[model samples]
Target chain A: MKKVLGVTLGILTAIGGFVDIGDLVTNALVGARFGLHLAWVVIVGVIGICLYAEMCGRVVAMSGRPVFDLIRERLGPRTGLLTLVASFLVTLLTLIAEIGGVALALELASGVHYLLWMPLAAFAVWLVIWRVKFSRLEQVFGLLGLLLVVFAVALFTLGPDWGQLLHQATRPHPIGHENWATYAYYGIALFGAAMTPYEVFFFSSGGVEEKWTRSDLVTARSNVFVGFPLGGLLSLAIMGGAAVLFLPAGIKVETLGQVTLPVAVALGKLGLAIVLIGVFAATFGAALETALSCGYTIAQYRGWQWGKFVRPREASRFHVVIIVCLVLAMLTLLTAVDPVQVTEYSVVFAAMALPLTYLPILIVANDPDYVGEEKNGPVRNAFGLVYLALLTVASAAAIPLMIITKGGQ
Target chain B: MPGESGRVLHAQLHLLDRQLIDQADGHLAGKVDDVELDLDADPPVVTALITGRERITARRIVDITTAVTVSVEDLDLDYYDDWVENHVIAKIPGARHAPE
Candidate 1:
């Protein structure tokens, strides 16, 4: 019973950890603009993330090495350095976007400009990464992020025609003469949001920090299988709300507040307050994850000591990287660049870097040299390979689709 | 430094760049940056694994005499010396007991 409960909690944390600013913004925006037509992309993205995350988690549990460590071993120094540069840039971009996202969520609640809160947000994110224990960080933010159930609650409160919602989700069509390029562009964005590389990095590294062993493979599997899909469900609820409330009114979701407007409209002030808390927890948690992910990727690649389990002064370089990445992200946000636009752009680039980050995990996981008796089973290998192919397509098309659709117009 | 039993069999495949693991608690030591091959044999054999950062930098890079050379060459060599323990890393501060 205790084992079951622990596994269940791990799964729940994964679900909450999965949804970040990208999914909240992209899913709602796409659902509002293109209706449920791009819903298929979310499903694809979730499957890809689950498969790769599971492989990476398994690899960590078995080998006690994180994905980036294996990436260095597999790619050698020069290519690994290249991977580190590209990945760090993309992860830094994501960190900046998430920092801006947390501030925006705070802004929605307090009515201050998000730009004013950016520095504080970045500092708090770094402090938490520096001091908070891995499990404590995940638990506090993960469970609190469950407040996003307001979207699910709002769906019931709005009492939408389920038949229509289901029908639209099943039969995806671009709404009202939108071109397929625009549709495909949003599809890539949604896909990118679901499969962001940092999640896998954070997940595998977190497994290592938590000291997950081969026996804990059950815990890891439970987390990826249950947590991610349920997290994806929250995204779907947000999309559903936007589709029901915003689409009918010809609205396009451009702001974080706009994404929560449906809950406010459907469930009033109480729902809006809950939605704000949920967004705060979600984005704040993601900010921590991505910031630490930046530190983890760099330190792991270079074989430096990292993790909050160690004292701050002991892992100076790791903490230094986190601080530097956070400052850079905050500085980027201070440029008054639209945070939402930055998020949209980050997710698309996440799509482009997907293969670089995940393919290493897939290769390492299947290596008997790494996992010994626990390499991927045939079925898992087939699933991973097919998803790898899909990721390649998504990655190949992400930039071109962005250019063609002018960042989804 | 080569013992009768511990000579380099294949430097690239077996020793160089492989992760050094402490035998006692399995905490990571460091990567085998480069090896010192003893010339006192019929053929050269690896004698000691050089695992420090300064040693690695000097061995890996070609031009160590550039404008940036002073900082790398001079900055407190003591810090790099104690970082990667020779042979095993079981003596590191946190490696003994299971982390609480």
Candidate 2:
């Protein structure tokens, strides 16, 4: 019974911890504009993340080293340093977006404007990282984030035509008057949202924080396999709800509020209240993850002691990096940039940065020195190489697509 | 180093940029940023691990496998770490306490 509960808890957290501002905004916007036509991208992304995250977890379990550590060892100093700078900038951009996301969610709940909430939200995120135990912090937000299941419930309540939705998903083309270029652009954005690079960084570092060993491989695999796919289902549910409520009415999701409207329309005020809390928990949780990932990437590359397992004074450089990142993110949010715009660009840039992060993980995972007898089998390598090819195409095309579509105008 | 003195190892493949773990407290000290090599030896051999972009010799190295484990009395490689801990991080309230 205890073992079942433990496994259940891990799965629930993975589901809740998966979605962030990028997933929420991109899925809703794409759904409203393209119906379910781009849903296949989300499916592809989920599989990609599950594959790489499993490798990252396995490496950490076997070697007691985080992803960035392996990145440096495998990529060497010059190329590794370049990758670090690029990955760090992208992760920092993600951190800024998440901070803005928490503030936006706060504004949705309080009606006080997101700018006023930015500093408070960032401070609270830092405080939790500074003062809370790692497991406790993860569990609290992960459980609360489950409230986003309201989207799935609301979609069923709306009673959309299941056959039509299935047709759109299968067809995978631009809907309405939208052209192929914009459709492909949005598809890449959805893919990027689902497989953001920071997720792997946070996952491997969190594994180390929890002290995962070879014996924990089964638990890690279960979390990646069971947890992430279910989380993707929730993303699809959000997209489907938007397609049902916003597509026919020609409503585009320009704000976080629009993402919640389907629930409010279907489930009324109680559902609105629940979904707001869900958004808050999910965005806030991601804020914590991205902030720590900024610290994790730098600290691991430089070989500074890191993780919430240590006292702040002990991991002083790591803690300092987190503080600095928060301050910068909060300041960027204060400039009144649209959090939604930040979310869009961050995910696209995340797609561009994907190869830099994952290629090294794939290389290191196959190295016997790191994983010993647990090195990648032929099947894993097959999928890994295929995804590597796909990711490279996405990375090369991300900027050109964004430009051609005028950032998906 | 714990390996046999005559053991053959490739410097770039085996040593460069590997993580340096302080075995005493099991904390990460730094990375092998560069290596000091004895060129007079027939094929040359690494004499010390350079860390923190400085030329400090990692004289206390205990093992050299995937990661290099060293037993240093003081992790002087982390000058920035000490300065930040004392002047910045320690000044914050509850800095000395681990999260509950």
Per-candidate count of clashing residue pairs (backbone under 3 Å): 1, 0
| lDDT tens digits by residue: candidate 2, B1-91 | 3226556778888888888887788888888888888888767766777887655454577777778888776547667888999999999
State, as a TM-score between 0 and 1, how close model 1 is to the true structure: 0.87
Chain B TM, cand. 1: 0.46
Per-residue accuracy of model 1 over A291-403 as CA lDDT, tens digit each: 99998988777656677666555455666678778878977888899989999999988888877787778888877757888888899888888888877888899888888
Q: Candidate 1, A192: how far from true, in Å?
A: 0.9
Query: Measured with DockQ on alpha carbons, how good is candidate 2?
Result: 0.81
Candidate 1 Cα RMSD (Å):
6.8
Which stretches of model 1 miss by more than 4 angstroms? B1-30, B33-100
**Interface quality of candidate 1 as DockQ:** 0.09
> Which CAPRI tier for candidate 2?
high
**What DockQ do you compute for every candidate structure?**
0.09, 0.81
- Candidate No. with top lDDT: 2
Native contacts recovered, in order, as a fraction for each?
Answer: 0.03, 0.83
